[model samples]
Target: MSDILKFPKDFYFGSATSATQSEGTFEGDGKGQDIWGKWFELEPEKFYNEVGPYKTTTMYKHYKEDIQLLKQTGHNSFRTSISWARLFPEGHGEVNEKAVAYYRDYFETLRENDIEPFVNLFHFDMPAALQDIGGWENRKVVDYFKEYAKTCFELFGDVVKKWFTFNEPIVHVEMGYLHQYHYPMKVDAALAVKVGYHTALASAYAIKEFKKLKTGGKIGIVLNLSPAYPRSNNEADLKAAEIAEAFQNKSFLDPAIKGEFNPLLIELIKKHDLMPDYDEKDLDVIKENTVDFLGVNYYQPVRVKARDSVPNPDAPFLPTYYFDIYDMPGKKMNPYRGWEIYEKGIYDIALNIKNDYGNIEWMITENGMGVQDEDRFKKDGMIEDDYRIDFYKGHLKWLHKGIQEGSNCVGYQVWTPIDCWSWLNAYKNRYGLIELDLETQERTIKKSGYWFKDLHDNNGFEL
Candidate 1:
C-alpha cells in the first residue's frame, strides 16, 4: 500500500448517509410515506428507471453489518440522519414506537462498535402530510419541525452528542420550491423564500430547545456551499458570480451562522417582490439562537455569469432568474462526476469561516465523488475504485491545508458510507466507500475504503 494519509488525532474521519437515502425500510416500522415515497408511486418514470426510495441500500437491516464495514475501513465516527416520518409518522403529532426502538438500537449498535454517531435531524425527507400542509411554505410547519427536533434530542440525545438540525437547508429550498427536481416541486420564488426563512427559523428554534434540554451536545445546520466563480474577470461576470454566491451560499450561511439574513438577498427578494410571509417574532427567535457548529458540504464550485436575457415572461423565479450557469473553460474536472474539480474551494470556505464568520468549529461533512454504477469493477469481492480514492486524496489535501491555516475545522465526513438514493438522481450517481450490491444485499469495500482504514490507523495520510 502507498504511504497512508491520516488525519489529526482529534480530527474525526467518517462517512455519512441520510435515512431516506440508505435505509430501505421507507414503508416499514410504522414509517409514514415521505414525498419521495409518494413521488415514486405517482410517477416512477421521473426517477432513473423507476427505482424508488424503498429499493435502496437497505441500511435499516444491515446497519449492524455495515458498522463492521465502517470499522474495517478505519471509521471512528459515522454520520446519518433520522427519518422524520420514522420518528413522527404524521410529521408532527405521533412518534412511531418502532422507529424509536430501531433508532435507539441503531445508535447503541454504533456506540457498541466504538463508532461515534453524528445524527442529523432533517435530510430532505419531508413527510407527505407536511407537504399537504404547505410543507415549509406554511409557517406552522416551523413549529412542527421544532417539536420534531426536540423530540429527537430527547429520544436519541443519550447516545448522540453531535446533532445537525438540517442538512443542506438551502438545497432543500432551492430544489423543493425554486426548482422542480424534488417532490412537491413548484417554481415559485416567493414560496421558496418563505420555505428558506422557515427552515432557518426552525433551525434556530431547535437550537433553543436543545439548549433548554441541556443535552451536553452541539447543534448545527449543514450547508452545501459551493464557492461561486465568475466566468471571466469582466464586471458582468464578476457581478454574476457575487449574485450567485449571495443567492446560494450566503442565503443560509449568513442566517444560520451570523444570525441575520443576507441584506442583498433580502433586497433582491424585495426587488422581485418575492418576500415571504413572516411574523415579527420569528426574526427575534433566529437572532437569539445560532448553531453550535456547522456542517459544510463542499462537493464542487459553481461557475456563473450574468444572464444575457431575463428569463421568460418577466416574472420572478429562482436564482436562475437573475443569473445563468456558465461552465468555465480550461478548468480541471472530475471525470467520475460531471462537477468541476476545485479542491481549493474547500480552503476558501474554511478561510471564509475563519476570517469572516468567526470560524465556529466546523467539519467537511459531505465531500465525495459519484461514479456511474461501480459494480463492474469488482475483483474478488472488492471494488478497485481508485478514482474515488484519488477524489478523497485531492479533497483531504485541501482539508488538511485548511486545518493548518487556522480554519477551526474538526472533522471530515464523506457524502456517504454506502451507495444510497440521491434525490432525483436516485441510484444513478453512486458515492460510497463500500459498494452495495442492490440485487443481493451484498456489500464490498472499494479501494478507497481500504485507504481510509490505513489513514485512520495512521492518524493522517502521507502523500
Candidate 2:
C-alpha cells in the first residue's frame, strides 16, 4: 500500500484534444473557415509538408471508435473544444445546426461511456470572419466571442459541466503578436497587450453570463504555465526570471484566478507605454467573476539568465527580452523531440498554487512529449512507444508528490488522446496514446495504452 500511487477521492484522469487538431472536415459540416484553414491556404509554405487543417484524424467520423479507446485506457473524463467557425460560420451572425449536431453526438458518446466532458469554447481557432474584422486586437471580437460562448452553453452546457473560456488566452496573444508564429502574425507588443486584455475581459463576461443561466456548471480558463528558473542564484538572473514568469504565466494566472492583474506586469506595460484600453467598470467585472477552476498546461520549464547587454534595438523583440533561454549543461532532454524534460517542474507548479496562488482547484490540462518523425516506431501494426510511457510515468511521480504535499490539483490530462496536428509542427510531434495513421485514419494503441488501463483499474499506477 505504501508504494501505491493514489489520487484523492474523485480525482479525475482524462486526455485532451482540440477540434481543428483532430476533427477533420474543416470545411465540411457547414463549418466556417478558421485561421488554420486560411493560413494553410494563403501560405502553404508556412506549414510542414504543406499539410493543412482539412487532413486530421477524422475524429468527426471516428469518435465512436476513439471513445472506446479512451475507455479502454481508463479515462474518467475528456477535454475537447467547440470550433467557433463550426457553429457560427461567420464570427457571430447565425448558428450552424450541422456543426451542433456533430458535437452534440460526439459529447453524448463520452457521457454514455461514463466519461465526463470537460469542454472548452476556443482553442485559438479564430474564425476567418473575425480575422477580417481585426480579430482579438479589435475590441469588437470580445463581444463576438461572448456571443459564441453563450451559444455553446445554451446548446451543450447540458452535457459539458466543466467549460473553459479559452484553452490558453495568453498563448494566443504572445504567439500572435510577440513571436509572430501564429496567423496574422505581428511583432507589436502594444497590440498584443490589447489582445490579451480583450481576451481576459471576454472571459470575465462569459463567466458572468454563465452565472445568469443558473446552470450550476463550473467556468475556467486554461493557461500554459512554464515555471521560469534562473540559471544561477544571482540577483539579476533571478529578477529577470521573475519578470518573465509574471509576463508569461501570471499575466493570465492572476486575473483569471485572483481577479486582479499583477502589479509587476502592469509596470512592464506602463514602461513600454502599452496600456490596454480598459474601462474603469471592467475592473469590477474581472474581480467579481474570477474563474471557479484553472486548467494548467505544463510542458517544460524555461531556464534563463539575465542579458549581459540590452537586447539588439533593431532585432525583433518580445516580453522574453529581459532574459535569454540558457542551455544548462547536464539538463535532461528528450532526444527525439529536443525538448528539455524536468519532472520537478510539475511539483513546483503545484506548490506555487498552494503557497502563492491561494490553493485554487486546477487540472493538468496538457502534458506530453512530442517526438518528430515517429513513423520508425510503426511496426507489427502498432507504434511501440516505450519513450512516451516513460514520459508519462516520470511526470506522474512529481504530480503524485504534489498531491502528498497537499496542493489543490484535482486531475491530470495529457496533451492529446490521439496523434494530431500541432500549431507549427503539423503531425511532426507524435504525443498520443493511440497512434494514428494519417493515411487510412486508422488508430492503433501502443503499450502505454494498456499500461494506463492497468493504472486506472487500480485507481493509480504503482509509483
Candidate 3:
C-alpha cells in the first residue's frame, strides 16, 4: 500500500467554501444586499426549507473557531470567496472598511493557524445594485469587477498569495440565462452568450489588473469541468458530446487557459446566430491576459446523445437543441445528491489537461459528495460518514494515478469545510467534513474529518 498510493509531500490538502454560503450576516455590518439576499425577500419559496443567506453557519462571527475546525480536519489550505457586496456596498465606489477589516483579520487568523488562504473575488452572489443595471450582461459590470479586484489586491496582497478571479463563471451564464436557476432567470440563448463572453472577458481583465500590482502571487479562474461522454460510439452521439463539451467546458477553459475560444464552440455559436457583440479590444484583452494557473471543480460527467427530433426553427436557441442529456443505465449514483459517481472522470480531466492543453499548474479546487438526511448517519457523538470517506478514497486513487502520469496536479480541496447553506438547495444536501447544527451553530468533526486528518498526516491512506 505504501508503494502503491502515496501522494507528494507538497500536495496540498484542504476544503473550500464561498462567502455567501458560509457567512450568515448578509445584511449586517454595512454589507449591501447581494442578489441572494434580495432574491430571498422577493421569493422566499425558492429556497429549500425556507432557509436563506441570513441563516448560514455565521462564519462572519465564528471564523476563528471555524479555522480551528478546518485545522482539526487536516486542512493545510482553505479556499473562500470575498463577497463583492460585502466589500463595496453598492458594487462600485466606496470600500466598506468594516468588511475590509474583517477579511484582514480573517486572513491573519488563518495564517496564524498555519493554513493558507485561497481567496476568490466573485462567487455567484452579485450585488443587487449591479444586477439592477445588468449583472454580467452589461459591459459596465466588467469594469466594476476589475476595480473590485484591484481593491482586494491593494488590501490583501501582502498575505494572500493565491487568488482566483471567479468561481465557476459558467454557472452565471448556464444557470442564470439558460436554465433559470439563478437570479434574473431568463432563457434567452443570445443573452446567455453575451453573459458568458463578458464573464470570460472580465476574468482576463482581473488577471491583467492583478499582474499590474506585481504582488508576486499566482492568479487564475476556477472552472467546473465535467467531461461530456457520448452514449455510444455512433457518429451522431459523438457529435452531440462534442457540442456539449464545447459549450460547457471549453467555453471558459479555452479562454482562461488557452487564451482563445474553441473553434468548434465558435462554429456552433455562429451556426445558431447567437454570437455576442464584441470588439477587437475585448478579443485582444482575452488573448493577452491568460491565467498563471488553473483551478478545476469536477463533480460528475455529462452523458449526451443525439436529439431525437430537430429543433423548431422559430423557437429560441438552446444548447440542448443539438443534443439531449442521456442517463447511462447502470451508472452508480450518490443516493442523496443524485449525482453520478464515476471516479475515473477525474483521471479523464487530468489527462485532457496534460495531453490537449499544456500541463499547466492546477489543483482540485472543489470536489465532494453532498448527502441529504445526513443526520441519519450520526452515531455516538459524531456522524459516521463512512460513505463520504469512500467517496474521497475513490477520487483520490484516480487523482494519484494522474499525478503519477505527470499531470502536474497540485492539491485537493473538497467542496466545503462544514455543512453550510447551499445556494438554492439550502440545507437540503450537506457536504462537509464538519457537521453544523443549524439551531445552535455548533460544529462537530465527523468521522470523515478525523480520517482526513490521518490521511493528511500520513500523506496517503491504505486503499
Candidate 4:
C-alpha cells in the first residue's frame, strides 16, 4: 500500500442522515406528525419490528452529543434535513418558533465545530397536514411547499450555506404512485406521472424562492442516480436501457440540472396518455431555476433488458412496459440488503455527468453498504466492518479517477453517520459509521468510523 490515494485538499468528507430518521422525539417540543408518523399509526405491521420513526436515535435531545460523535468520526461536513412538519405543525400559516430556534442552534453548533452543514428541506417526510389535501398530487400543495421553503430560508438561511430542496424526489413518485411501498399507495401510472412532475415543479419553485430572499446560499436537489446498463448490445436491449435511464435517472436530473424536461420522456408519457396537468407558469419556473450544484446518491446500477413477454393490453400501465430489470448471473451481492454491488457503476455515473451535464459540480451524497444483524460481526465492543471499508475504497477509487479526469466532484459523504431507525426497514439494515445500542441508547464508534477518521485527517488513504 505504498501509493496513497490522495484527494484534493478541499474535498469534503462527511456522512449523511435525515431528521425523521435520526430525531426520535417526533411529537414533543411542538413537532407535528409527518407522513411517516401517520403511516406508522395506520399500518404498523409494514415497518420492520414495528419500529417507527419515533424510535430513532433521539437527535433532537442528543444533537450536541451527536455533533461530537460527528467530529470524532472525522466529518468535515455533514448533511441532514429539516422536518417541514416540525417547523409548521399544520404545514402552513404560523411558524413554530421552537422549531426555528432548534434548527438555528443545530446549524450553529455544526459551524462552531468546524463542520459544514449541508441542510436539505424535504427528505420523503411530507407533513401529514399537506397529505390530507392531496400532497404532491394537487397543484395547491406546490404553493404550500414554496411558502414552507421561503420560511425555512428566512429562518435558517444565515447559518446554513448549503441547502437542498429535496432528496431522492423520484422515490416518492415510484413508491407512492407506481408501487405500493409508500403511504397513500396507489398503483396508477397517470398519477405517477403527475406526482413526478409536481415534485420537479415544487423543487424549481423552492429554488426560485431561495433566490428571491438573496440568502447567498447554494441550493440543489439530492438525487439517487442509478445508471442503466443493457444486458446485451441488441437494439431491443439498448432501447430498454435507454427507457430505464429516462424514467429513473433523467426524470429529475434533467429538470433540476438542465432546467428542462427530457422531450423523450414527455413523448413516452404522452404516448401512454399519462401526461400530467401543467401550465406555462410552472414550466417557466423550472426553466428559469436550475440547481447551483448536484448531490448524487448511487447505490447500484439498474441492469435492463428488452421485455421478453408481451404485456396484457388490458392491464394498467407502468413505466416498465418497454423494459424489464435483468438480473445478471454471478453478480456480486450485498446479501443483507439484496442489492447488487458493482463498484464501477459509480465510475460510469461520474463520467456520464462529466460528458453530458457539462461536468457540473457534484458530490457523492450517499453511498454505503447496509448490513443486517451487524452484531454478529461485533468484536471487543466494536463492529469489525472491514467489508464497509472495502466498499468505500472501491467506490472512492472510481470517484477519485472521475475527479482526476476533470469531473467537478467535490466530496464524499457516506449514507449515514450514527446507526438510526430507517424507514419501513427499521433497524434491519445498518449503514452507520458509529454503532447505536438501541437498548441503552448508547453510541460507540465502529472500526470503519476509526478508519474514516484517519482517511479524513490524511485527506486520503492507501489503496
Model 3 C-alpha lDDT per residue in residues 23-98, reported as the tens digit of each score: 8784559998999999999998998978889879899999999999999999899999999999999999999999
- Residues 226-326, candidate 1, lDDT per residue (tens digit)? 99988898999898988999998999889888899999899888988888777778898888898889999988899898898868866646677767899
Candidate with the larger lDDT of 1 and 3 = 3
Model 4 ranges with Cα > 4 A deviation: none
**TM-score between candidate 1 and the true structure:** 0.96
What's the lDDT for all of these models?
A: 0.86, 0.88, 0.92, 0.92
Model 4 weakest 10-residue run by lDDT: 23-32
1 or 2, which is superior by lDDT? 2
In the range 109-200, model 2's lDDT, one tens digit per residue, is: 99999999999989999999999989998989989988898888888888889999999888889889888789888888888999999989
- For residue 257, model 1's alpha carbon misses the true position, in angstroms, by 0.9
Give the runs in model 3 whose Cα sits over 4 Å from its true position: 1-4, 26-28
Q: Give candidate 1 misplaced runs (Cα > 4 Å).
A: 1-6, 26-28, 310-313
Q: Which candidate, 2 or 4, has the higher lDDT?
A: 4
Off by over 4 Å in 2: 26-28, 313-317
Error of 2 at 181 (Å): 1.1
Clashing pairs in 1: 4-461, 5-460, 5-461, 5-462, 6-460, 6-461, 7-459, 7-460
